[model samples]
Target: MTDQVEERVLSIFREKFHKPEVTIDSSFAELGIDSLDTIEALFEIEEEFGISIPDDAARSLNTFREVVAGVEKLLAEQRIANPPAAAGPDAAEEGR
Candidate 1:
């Protein structure tokens, strides 16, 4: 899942800034992407992953990895709150 997140994010950077070499560890400021580009990237990320990043938290992210970690953390919390349905032969026994 982390790999998927990294790939999707890298694609966003490449598409938005036309910088295919931009990597996951690359600093946003050092990537040469302007403020508007960063905003657009954030919007794309939120929409793509269906997650909301508060302004304060968003401001703290300096690399694509940070954003991915944030998204993963949110997803982990969500999963714990609403776990998946049980299955398999032991399902009923486990429920008891």
Candidate 2:
């Protein structure tokens, strides 16, 4: 999951910054990403992943790896918050 997320995110970084060499270990500073770039990238990420990243987490992320980890954490939290309901006659009756 992390690997897939990392690849998607790295793609976003590459497209946003026009840098084809962006890697998971690349620091934002090393990539010459500024505050505005970070905000834009975060917005793009949220839109792409359907998850909201908190300000603290966003601010704390310095590398691509951290961004991937943060996205994974948010996805886990989303799953916990909205787990799938059991499917059976009882669930159908409850819905009715």
Which candidate number maximizes TM-score?
2
Q: How much is the lDDT of residue 75 in candidate 1?
A: 74
How close is every model to the real structure, measured as TM-score?
0.79, 0.86
Error of model 1, residue 45, in angstroms: 0.7
Per residue, candidate 1 scores C-alpha lDDT tens digits across 2-95 of 8998898789888888898888788888987766677789889888887777888877888888877888887777667656658433555788
* Candidate 2 Cα errors over 4 Å, as ranges: 86-96
Report per-prediction Cα RMSD to one decimal: 3.4, 2.8
- Model 2, 27-85: lDDT tens per residue? 99998998789989999999999999888878888898889988998998887777666
Judging by lDDT against the true structure, name the best candidate.
2
Question: Backbone clashes per model, in order?
Answer: 0, 0
lDDT of each: 0.80, 0.89
Residues forming the 10-long window of minimal summed lDDT in candidate 1:
83-92
Which window of ten consecutive residues has the lowest lDDT sum in model 2?
Answer: 83-92
